[model samples]
Target: MNRPHDPAPGASPAPRATDWIGTPVTADLLRGALDLERTEHGVLPHRLPARARAQCADGQLAMAEAQPSGVRLVFRTRAAAIELDTLRTKMAYQGAPPRPDGVYDLLVDGSLAGQASVTGGNVLMVDMTTGTAETRPGPVGTVRFTGLPDRVKDVEIWLPHNEITQLVALRTDAPVEAVPPGGRRVWLHHGSSISHGSDAASPTTTWPALAASLGDAELINLGLGGSALLDPFTARALRDTPADLVSVKIGINLVNTDLMRLRAFTPAVHGFLDTVREGHPTTPLLVVSPIHCPIHEDTPGPSAPDFSNLGAGKLQFRAAGDPAERAAGKLTLGVIREELSRIVKQRAADDPHLHYLDGLGLYGEADFAELPLPDQLHPDAATHRRIGARFAELAFGTGGAFAARPA
Candidate 1:
């Protein structure tokens, strides 16, 4: 096999045309995607299936599910070099700053092997002030990873968690085949932006991805950014997906959007759980409350972008709703935590497999003091590692819900 390699931090050169073998990006060679749509350019992975997506018209959910936070190409190959042609849709905010290109993480035999990013692609420009977006067409880009050990090994190329990527083509110097399932428990997780990998170093470094690694489980992440607002469609998506372990991180997005009052939130939570139970009656289901966000702990949200530092090329967020609104049934982080705890406790009376996790135990005020959130909302990369470690301990540790069972 040709041993072409690149040391630069960005894109890599593709293998020579005639010498490389082409492989179709099929669902069997992919993980973490609930549905795959055949686009004009290539295949697009979707976190939510077509039925659920058809029910919602919200733009945020549409974009979030299409980003493929935990999606990756998984296969067995002896290829010394690999190349992926992709059409990526990158996001840009008007008057703010150009976000860095999304990263692609490569793993060999469950270990991080290399990392790279595709350069120019479609740009989705959003006007933060007007809440409107325009898409500008661009060309497909290639990301290559070379110099493998040249032995039979399992390989995974994790797609960017924050960008919409359409897989155009995959090429390798050697032949490729479907990797047999590794027998790891499939962990399906649903959460907010933090779980969606905001500010994470790479796709595999996201908290859910990290925890999945530490827990020795295969992951299907449904962590939609800014859209986990207890929507029925989202809950249905979680219900329909097959998984051995299921976790839903609630409250953060609810508070961020101020989408519902306490009365509505309670029934919504129950209904969401009910739908999931229909599909997974005895599956181990864990409900996780939101982590500590000082800005939204007591203050109700309708969190708005703190563009005060936009001129300095930094964009932060701030809670816009008044704390006094909580008295009038408005939801806050603190209130949501308390309600989630109560609801889980009440339902656990009959549901032996149901569990509740306090997000504070994962990243509380103490941790916040040491590693503050850069955007005043999402955790930074370091915090992502910390949270992932704590979660693995709490949920998959001995006597935890995801602990291994002996035959």
Candidate 2:
């Protein structure tokens, strides 16, 4: 493949549609998404079906589920050039530094081939203090990738994990068809912002995505940012989705959001696991506790943004709840990890396919000292890679929880 044709991320006039063939963005072409809702502008891919979305009016959950962490368009074609028209809605923190535009990753024949970012679409201005937001509409933009090999091959365009994207159209110089499944096991994962690819360089580089690539599994990522609080709707969605392997990374979001106390945490977890097993009985299911986060390790949350560096164009977070509150059953990461381990052990006796992974094993105190979380929450791009590599080894490697069994 030739060097990627990269234009800066910004608004540009779209190429005339008459020059290229247009393909409808349909469900068959989409992978890793549970539903596709038709909008006035285009079809928006959703990780959670409409029923699950209808049950929650929380804006955070709505945005996170629509961002499409692991969702991609996969097809077979000989097109030497491709253009995707998308209406992307990005978020901006009020009084804080502007976040980068989300990236669109292109893979040819299962390899990283090219990457691009769309410029203009929409922006959601958010006030961290007030928890309010305003939407500013912009023009739809196009992401173009050229100089692909002129031969029959598979192509995949992974959507940005942090942006709400609407597929306006797909244009190519040649015809395209859906790529049939290659029989790889499907790995479904659900977690918080870190697993949602918060600061990762691009979509395919997210830890869960990286682990899936290494494990040679198809990924369905439900890593909703700031919204993985063991919601019943989420568990129900998991229960209904089809998957050969499954994992749920729990704790950080619960602690940070202060969504529950010890009294509710145990039963919530059991219910979540029970729901998943209803659909995937005997399938390998792994339960992961929180990784090492110093701020929440001993202190309970209701985490708040630290605006001290706002003038310097940086944003950080602080655990606001008192450490003493743990005595009242308020949850902390330390408390969460212990409780999660106990819950899994108790259930595993009756569920042979169930397993537990201490998230500390993926990123422990030692790793933290070497590569601390940049914002005292989500991992940086380097840390994403590190965590992804370790997870692949421990979860998919020999004797691991998700290890392949003899047929």
Candidate 3:
């Protein structure tokens, strides 16, 4: 594993910078982040803030929040070349084979311009057998992009949605400045791994990212993998964040974690919405239930990993709880969907801006039959594109939940 110290075989040298100014990664230049925290190395973006993170010491939540899905470094620069150094914490299953490197996507003037990946970074070794994790420190890695248009233009370096990255340093051949806020509406979304771009091809390819692009909106994704459990802190975070459109994709995480039952679920949903409404009383708030997950559609969960394919370096998920538990108030996707629709309908009488979307509309049983989930859980790249396109049409198109109003 040699670090990428030099340019590729035929690549030209980066432009010489007599004055390479390093800008501090602050909240102003960061898009799609709800909060930022100072770390020992550098600034780390969080979907939830310090207060919210303090409430839950769950390792899963910590990891998910730090991953910075849909977050990017946005700035305007006239430089032809730009480089960013990041201290990434890459996860590795203790006994399983290593996974692929996370990708960094650079967009110029709102279009995909370049892409690259770093070499060395920290390793988070997770032992499945013992349920223990250890962090091994490693060298920081740099992602560099060269040969850009030599005119003043907007640049966005979208960090990997899957990796926990700490912004170590940024350098450019020319000076860079923050991009001013545009007239686009801000869309704030909260959900689970699917929304976090679990198996998406790249950072910008995530469903929410794609939807934001099609809707012509700014996106702040709070998609915490395996951690969207209707936590009060998360709701408060959403409540406080400024957004014109808000959405919370519920059910899948609740089902997979077996975190709550129907009895506690209704009130939790109400309370979460109540907190959000306190900040944006009239903002369009769309409640999205889980997509079609065959394993947990009618069955309760506490999903477990299927290790039968471990020898082949494949990990799959299966629902472990019984379907009969629904009678005891245990939750399932089907159960949660009904409850969510009922709750939204009851509240919409008093809160006209509130709405609900059955996630099955984005990825339903029929779609799943044609494009089966490879892991029996998360959707594949193609499915992500399909979902994103459908969501853009349903939620942001004309007369849709988040559609623009006529002047």
TM values, all candidates: 0.96, 0.96, 0.97
**Model 1, backbone clash pairs (residues 3+ apart or across chains), number:** 0
Over the stretch 186-241, how does candidate 1's per-residue lDDT look in tens digits? 99999999999999989999999999999999999999999888888888888888
Number of clashes recorded per candidate:
0, 0, 0
Residues 1-407 of candidate 2 have per-residue lDDT tens digits of 21123532442333355768899999989999999999999999999999999999999999999998999999999987789999999999898778888998999999998888888999999987788999999999988887687899999999999999999999987899998878999999999999999999999999999999999999999999999989989998898988999999999999988988999999999999988988999889999999999999999998899988976777889999999999999999999889988998999899988999999999999999999998899899999999999999999999999998999
Candidate 1 collision pairs: none
Candidate 3 at residue 347, lDDT?
99
Q: List ranges where model 3 is wrong by over 4 Å.
A: 1-12, 17-19
The lDDT values for all models are 0.91, 0.91, 0.90
Stretches of model 1 off by over 4 angstroms after superposition: 1-15
Give candidates' CA RMSD values in order: 2.5, 2.8, 1.9
